[model samples]
Target chain A: MLLEWILGFVFLIVKLTIVLIILLTVAAYLVWVERKLLGRIQARYGPNRAGEFGLLQPLADLVKLITKEDTVPQEANKGIFLLAPGVVGLMALLIFAVVPFGSGVTLWGRSIPLVITDLNVGLLFILALSSISVYGIALGGWASNSKYSLLGGIRGAAQMISYEVPMGLSLVPVVMLARSFSLVEITNAQSARPFIFVQPVSFILFLIAALAEIKRIPFDLPEAENELGAGYHTEYSGMRFGLFFLGEYITMIILGSLIAVFFLGGWHGPLLPPIIWFLLKVGIIVFTLIWFRATFPRIRYDQLMNTGWKVLIPIALLNIVVTGALVLGTS
Target chain B: MGTIKNLAEGITALLKGLATTLKILSRKPVTEQYPEYRRPLPARSRAVIVLTRDPDGEERCVACYLCSAVCPVSCISMQSAEREDGRRYPRWFRINFARCIYCGLCEEACPTLAIQLTPNFETSGRDILKLVYEKEDLLVNHGGKNNEYNFYKRAGVAMVGDKGTQINEDKPVDLKSNLP
Candidate 1:
């Protein structure tokens, strides 16, 4: 029994280390991919100087950020200013603990789960953690002692808070269809077919809500660079800003994973390992997100709010009712 | 019905924009990887100013102050000198390229075709004084736009040879021979 416990702990630690490294590396490289794809979309060549197609750009950026001066505004709230970015990074990283990349494979005659921890309420955990990241943007913006940051913070907070309602509602149909809150169970339930096909309305609603959740192109009023001069992190420099950036990309990846697990049937494909399949699905989703960015312009703040409160929420709620009725009638 | 049609049109329009960008994305970029691959500029394109020579290997400039006077930026300055053969030239012409706007105005004002703008516009330098081109630096061996046409050749002047020997000349109107 002790040996089993020791092995489990060691396995958990190993998976944790591997996941953290993979997550951080993928997040960094996502920035490069976005720039390259955006450049291609705009008919230009993106960063190809440093180490063959700018592969080392993230490392260079990390070094520059580390060497930069850490500034805290004199009149700003020192404590929250220092703490906010960490909150963003930590919450983004934490959500992945419940996300299963693949099914178990026998190693040394012991079966192990692929994810860090299989939380029973994995879907709820993701929603809660993602909602918590709003505090990071809010506190960072509020503590900056600048008008631009303050306005950005207020808009970001309002947008995030409004979107969370629709985002949570859209996932109701997924949860109902899966008949479980655990992401692994959700993926397993889609063995016959993915929930996207089963619930197309839910799929569409979830995608829009998730995009807003990540503050992407159409919903990115908070950090609308042209208007707010970087919004929340206007006063932040060095690794603090890096943390916010890292957190944002990590959230993108996490969102991709959640969407993959809940809607696209995670790790279910032919002629490939489950982990590879999971990665492939997430890549497709991430590519779609980047494509959306390249295609659309940022919506106005009022429009973003209207879309969330009026359009998405109403549709999501109606989707839940119909999905519930269908599931009940079929069962 | 109107709202539904409008929504459909809006979606179609967005899809069209995306399709256009995607098509462009597949096409090769028009970026001119400058510094490595310079594009061929037109011959008449105004850029760096240069002093051209006459066909007989002499300075074609009459040191006329027209270029300096017409220059909006007043970047051109020179001293007029007279040769032993009664030819006028700029003794020491200087153009502060730092101030030259490459507007081709100087080229237009030059009656002698001495001043001309070339397509070689890469005049960037770290030091400001280095861009201040003197006569020797600005002078080029070629006759620029009018390679064969020397200014004093047909200007009713006695610079190179006697005025009657000049091309397209009528021997100074010939007052002694005119009867009609």
Candidate 2:
């Protein structure tokens, strides 16, 4: 029994290490990808200087961030200010623990799941963790003792909380159809047909809400750069700022994965390995997000609120009701 | 019905915008990498200043002080001195290119066409003193814009030749003759 426990512990560590490394590396490269894509879309060659096509730019940026000074504001809350970026970074990383990239595999007479831990209430866990990450932004801004930072923090808190309603409501249909809170079960339920075909409304609602949740373009009022002068992270410098940046990018990837798992039928495709199919779906979603950044203008604050509260929430609630009825009738 | 139609229009507009950017993504970027490529500048483009010689291989500048007087930034200065052949020359011509605005006013003010602007504008240097060009640095062997122009030859000066022997001048009326 002890040997079995030890073996399971070792397997968990190995999987955790692999997934963490992949996530960090991919997050780093996504910055390069976003820059290059945004450049190409706008008729410019972005960052072709560091190495071949600026593949080494992220490395250079990492080195630069590390060597720089970690500054703290003179008249600010020191402890929360220091901890804020780490909170954001840690929460983003933690959410990935429940994300299943592939089905379990049997090796040496033992079955090992691809994900770190297949929590039963994975979706709620994600929503809760994301909600908690709001504190990171809010506290980071509040502790800075600057007017711009405080305003940005307030906007971020309000926007995130408002959007979470529609985001949660949209997922109700998915849960209704799949009949389980477990992500693995949701993926299994979609082996025949992905939920996107049945509930495209939910997919769209989730997408818009997810974009806002991740603080992407058109919904990026928190750190709008023009308005808040980098918003919550105005006082952050060096690797602390790097931490906020890393958190943003990792959340992007996480949201992409969540979208893939929820809507596009996670890891269930013919003529390709499950993991490859999973990655391809995530890649397409990520590219689309970047394309959205290039194409769309940032909506006004009033418009953002109207879209989230007035339009998205109503649509999502209606979608859930309709989906629940249809699911019951069909089942 | 109006609200529904409005929604349809909004969705299509968003899609159209996405399509436009998508099309641009496939096209080649217009960025010209500097260091790797340099475009050809026009010949008349004003840049670095130079001192040009006359077609006879003689210094065309008479050091008349007109260019120095006309320089708005006071970048140009020279000490005028007469040579052995009664030819006027600058003893120590200097142009503080650091102070020069490259307005081409000095070029316009130079009657002899000795002081001219060149198309080679890459005069940047780490040392401020290096940008202060002396007479030797500015002097070029050939005429700049017009090779045939010899200021002394056209003028009524006796330095190049006797007054009547000049190419474009009529024979000076003999002062001893009582002819009108």
Candidate 3:
């Protein structure tokens, strides 16, 4: 019995190590991918010098960030300043603990799941952990003792709180359809027909809310470069800045995966393996996000808040009601 | 009903923007990939300063300090000296390329056709000191822009030959024996 426990523990550690390595590498490369896409959109070449097609830019950026001086402001709260980026980066990564990448496969007479942990309330866990990342931005900004940083911090708090409502409400229909909080179960429910086909309205609502949730373009008022000088991370430098960047990109990947799981039928397609399908869905979502960025200019702050509170929240509530009625009528 | 129409218009506009960007994304990049493929510059493009020789294979610059004086950044400086034949030339001309704005003012101020701006702009160097060019560094053994322009020939300096030996010479210098 003790031998079995030890083996399970060792495998768990191995899985955790593998996920972390892959996640970090993917997060780094996603930045490169975004830049390359943005450059192409703008009719220019982006970062083609470091390695072939700028494949090694992330490596060069890593070295630069690591070697740079970690500067602390004179009047800043040093402890929180040091720890805030950790909160953001770590929380972003922690959300992936429950995400099911692919189904289980038996090896050596034992079934090993692809995911690190299959939490029953995986979706809730993701939402909650993502909420925690806001603190990192707010605290990091407030700790800097700069006016722009303070404003950015305030903007982040307000924006996140407003958008979180619509984002949560958008996912209610998915939960109703799947009848389970487990990400794996939710995915399995859509194995035949994706939630997107049935709940197209909710899907659109979810995507819009997800963009705001991630503070992407037209909703990125917190990190408004023109107004707030990079918003919550204005005073952050070196690897601390890198940590915030890592957090942002990791969140992008997580958002991409969640969108895949909820609406597009996670890891489900014909011919191709579930893992490939999952990644393909994610790649499409990421490309769409980049396209949105390239296409849309930043909306006004008032417009952002108004859209969330007035438009999206009401629509999501109505969607839930409509979905509930349809589900009852059909069943 | 009007609001729905407006929303549809807005979305359509956004879709149009996406299509435009997507089209750009598919097209070939206009980047020259500089250093690997240099774009041919215009002939009059001002960049590095060079001293050119006259058609007679003699130094053309009289070093009258006009170029140095007219230089906006004061990047040019030189010592003027008269040769044994009374032809003036720069003893030691220097141009601090670090300060050079490539304004071509020095080229414009030059009386002789010696000081010319070349289209070669690849003057980047790791060392600041390496950017400084002296007379020998700037001087080239070929006439630039207007090759036939000789300052001495035009200025009536009796350097190459005495008066009347050259076409434009007023008369031979009245040396006492020649006068007799």
Candidate 4:
């Protein structure tokens, strides 16, 4: 029993270390990807001087963020203000625990699940954790005691909640097809047949809804620079602001991975190993997200909400119903 | 009937919107990668002004200061002096291109056909002083294609003679005779 406990602790540490490395690297590259892709779209050269093709630009940004002085508002809620970004960053990192990087392999004389935990209700767990990220935004805005931040927070909360319905509904067909809340099972089912082929409409709804959830362009109402002056995390500075920035990109990576696993047959391909296939799929999805960001303009708040509640929600419901009927009829 | 028609119209509109997006997605991007592909400037493009000489390589300017006077940006500065042969000439001509708006008005106002706009528009410089074109830098050996036709010779402006030698005036119009 003692040996088992020690082994578990070691495994936990290993998983945590892996998650940390992946999150930091993904977040850093996301900045590079955004600049390079946006530059191409705008007919301008993005950062190409920091390192070879500006690969080290993110590192330079991190150094700048670190060296800068941490500023705090005199009238701000010091406790909540300090804790907000930490909450966001931690929540973003935690969501990666259940993300199956590859199938189980025998390690140290035991079969390991590759994932940190393969909980039966993994999907629900992810949803719950993702929902908790909203608190960080809300808390940041409220603690700042700034009107713009307050408005941003209120808008972010409403937007997130409104989109979550369609986002959740979009996943219903996948769950129905896989017949399990377990991410591993869903991935396994996807190997047999990618869900995108069967549920293209649901995939589209999920992409749009997920983009909204992550507050990307066309749905980036929370931090509308022109409208809200940096939005919920406006007053945040130094490492605190960096943490929020980190959280945002990490969320993008996680969503990209989720999309890959759910619809694009995660880790399933010929010749290349499973991990490589998974990375390739995630990379493609992330590129598509960045492409959309560069190409499209931000939607207005009312329009965003209308699209979510009125348009997406109905379509997602219809998709689920149709998927259900098709599955039943086929079976 | 109206509700059903509205629904059909909405569906058609949505499909049309989707089709447009798909068309754009399939088409090649319209972006022109500049620096690699330079665009051709139009014939009448007013990029920069240059001073021109006659075919005989004589300076066409008579130091009239018309270009300087008409310059909107006040970029042109020149001093006029009479030569030993009693011919007007510019002693020093300078144009601070940094301040010049390249409006082509100076070219239009040069009565002597000395100034003309050129096609060379890429004039960016690291230093402001480098942009200031002196007389030597602005002067060109050939009269620009259109300015080859001398305005002074064609307009009956006498250069060396009194009123009787002026062209097209019929010996000062014989003002005492009023001939039919």
Candidate 5:
């Protein structure tokens, strides 16, 4: 029993190391991918100088960020400003803890699950961590002691709060359909068919809310570069700025994974290995996000609020009721 | 019913926008990758300024300071001196290329056809002082552009040869021959 526990501990360490490395690497490369794809969409080549197709750009960017001078405003709250970036990065990483990438695989006559932890309320864990991530933005903005950053922080806090409700409500139909909050069980439920086919309204609502939640373009009023001069991170420089970007990209990947697990039938495709299917789904979702960025113009702040509260929340509530009634009648 | 129609139309507009971008994404990018492929510039395309020699391999500049005067950025400076042969030349010509706007005004203002613009605009330097080209850096062996037109040969100046011996000049009528 002691030997078994030691082996399990070792495996856990290995898994943690692997996940961290992969997540960080993917987050870095996603920046490159987004640039290249957006460039192509706009009829240009982006960052092709560093390496073959600018593969080394992320490394170059990392070096540049590290070498840059990290400035702290004289009048700013130094402690919170310094800690804010870490909160965002840490919260993003924490959310992935409950996200199952694949089913358990038997190795060395032992069954190993491909997640850090399978929390019973995995969905709630994701929501809570995402909520906590807003503090990173809000605090980073407020601590900067600049009006632009303050405005950005307030906007980020308000937008995130407004969108969080619709985002959570949209997931209700999925939770009801799966009848379990554990991501692993949710995946198992969708072994027959992905939830996207049955609950497309939920999928659309979730997609929109998730896009707003992530502060992507068309809903990126928080960091509206033209108006806010880099928004909440106006005063952030060097590695701190890099940390914020790292957090954003990691959350993008996390959202992709969550969507895959919740709606796209997590890693259950025939012929291909489970992990590959999961990756492919995430890639598609990430590509769509980039495409949306390239296509859509940023909506007005009033339009954004109107769409969120008056439209999305009401639709999500109605969707929940209809889905609940259907589930009851079918059962 | 009206709200539903409006919603449908709004979504359609978004879908149309997405389609347009998707279509462009499928097409080839229009970027011309520099360094690997240099576009051919026209002969008259103003860029790096050069001092050209006369066809006889003589410096064409009379050091008249016309280019220096017309230079908008005041980048050109030179000390004028008369050679032992009575030909004029710049003793220590300089151009602060870092200050040059490539306006071609100096080229247009050049009376001796010595200063001309070339298409070779790839000049870059790590140090600011490196961009300040001296006479040696600007001087070229060949008579650039109008190679046959020597300033000294056509100027009717007595320096290159006697005034009557210059090209396109009328012979001096002698008073002694007119005595008949």
Candidate 6:
């Protein structure tokens, strides 16, 4: 029994190591992807010389960030200021735990699920953790003691809260259809058919809400450079700033994964391994997000709020109603 | 009854919004894969300037300071000197491209058939000093590549003994003519 526990602990460490490496790598490459996609959209070459089409651009960025000095405000809460970025980064990493990368497979005389945890309340866990991410932004902003940062914090918190409603409501149909909160079970439910066909409106609402949740373009009012000057984490420098950047992209990845699992049919395809299909779907979704960033201009703050409450929330509710009716009619 | 219809209208508007988004998704992306595809620039693209010689192998410029005086960046610097045969020529003309705005004002200001803007705008360099163009660097053997008509001839400027000669304009109006 002791040996089994020791082996389990060892396995857990190995899984965590792999997850950390994968998340960091994905976050770095997402930055590259954004630049390249934006470049294509704007008719210019973006970072193609750092190393073989700028693959090493992220490495250069990482090095630059590390070498830079870490500065804290003199008249601010020192402990909270230091802790905020760590909180954000940890929360971002934690969301990936419930995300099922692939079906369980035997390896080295041991069966292991590709995800860290297959929690029963995975969706709620993700929502709760994501909400917690807002505190990091708020604390960082407040700790900076600057009016811009304070304003940015207020905007970010409000935006996150406002958008979270539609975002949660949009997922109701997916949960209703799957009849399980477990991400593994949800993946299994999607094995035969993707949720997109049955819940198109929910899927659309989810995409928009997820984009807003991630604080991407068209909904990036908090970080509006023209007005707020780099937003809530404006005064953050070095690895602190890097942490926020990392957290943002990781959130994007998590959202993409969620979308893939919920709508695009997680790990369900012919003539390919489950993991490959899952990754391919997630990749396509991430690329679409980048494409949106490239193509669309930022929306105004009032317009963004209007879109959440007046547009997305009602549509999400209607989708749930319609989906329920269709399911009942078919039954 | 009107409120129910209003709700239906709102749903239609939402459908329209989705349709618009679907249209965008279906259409071919306006994105240009830049490294693979080069954009075509116009013939009169404001780029760099180059000095040129005439077809007869004679320098087009006669130590004219029009280009220098008109340069907005003051990049153009030149000194005029007389040759043994009393012919005036630029001893040393240089343009510090580092300071140049590429406004093409110098080309416009040149009275002589000397400076002309070309479509070769790709002039990036690591060294600032390398951007400075000397007389030899600016001088081109061919006459203004784009300008078919020589400016000196077009302006009807007297060149040495070729005064009051060539093309429309009866004998330079014989300064003292009263036949108006």
Model 3 lDDT tens row, A1-331: 9999999999999999998999999999999999999998888898898899999999999999999999998999999989999999999989999988887778999999878898999889988987888899899989988888889989998898888889999999999999999999999999999999999988988888888878899789999999999998999899999999999899889888998999999999999988999999999998888888988999999999999999999999999999999899989
Chain B TM-score list for all models: 0.80, 0.81, 0.83, 0.72, 0.85, 0.67
Backbone clash pairs for candidate 6 read none
Task: Give one digit per residue, the lDDT tens place, for model 5 in A120-164.
Answer: 999999999999999999999999999999999999999999999
Descending-lDDT candidate ranking: 5, 2, 3, 1, 4, 6
lDDT of 2: 0.93
Better of 4 and 6 by TM-score: 6
lDDT string for model 1 (B1-180, tens) is 998999899889889877877777787766677878889999999999889999888877889999999999999999998878788888999999999888888899888898999999898999999999999998899999889878887787787788688877765666778655
User: B17 in model 1: Cα distance from truth in Å?
Assistant: 2.9
lDDT of 1 by residue, A123-225 (tens): 9999999899999999999999999999889998998899899899999989998889998999999877988898888888888888888888878888999
Model 4, which residues run further than 4 Å from truth? B1-180
Cα lDDT tens digits for candidate 2, A1-331? 9998998899999999999999999999999999999999999998899999999999999999999998898999999999999999999999999999998788888888877898899999999999999999999999998888888899899999999999999999999988888898899889989989988999999999999998999799998899889888888899999999999999999998998899989999999999999999999999999999999988889999999999999999888888888888988
Docking class of 2: medium
> B1-180 in candidate 6: lDDT tens per residue?
997899799668656654455455445556566557778878688788888876556677766888889888899899998767655678998999999998998888776657888888888989999899998898888887544545445455454336566455356555587887
RMSD of 6: 6.8
What are the TM-scores, per candidate, against the unseen true structure?
A: 0.76, 0.78, 0.85, 0.67, 0.83, 0.68
| Candidate scoring better on lDDT of 3 and 5 | 5
- The 10 consecutive residues of candidate 5 chain B with the worst lDDT sum are B171-180
Each model's TM-score for chain A is: 0.98, 0.98, 0.98, 0.96, 0.99, 0.96
Highest lDDT against the true fold, candidate: 5
Off by over 4 Å in 2: B42-180
- Which residue pairs in model 4 clash with each other? none
Whole-model alpha-carbon lDDT for candidate 5 = 0.94
Instruction: After superposing candidate 1 on the true structure, give the runs of residues whose Cα lies further than 4 Å from its correct spot.
Output: B40-180
Model 3 residue B59 CA deviation (Å) reads 5.4
Q: After superposition, how far is residue A308 of candidate 2 from its true place, in Å?
A: 1.0
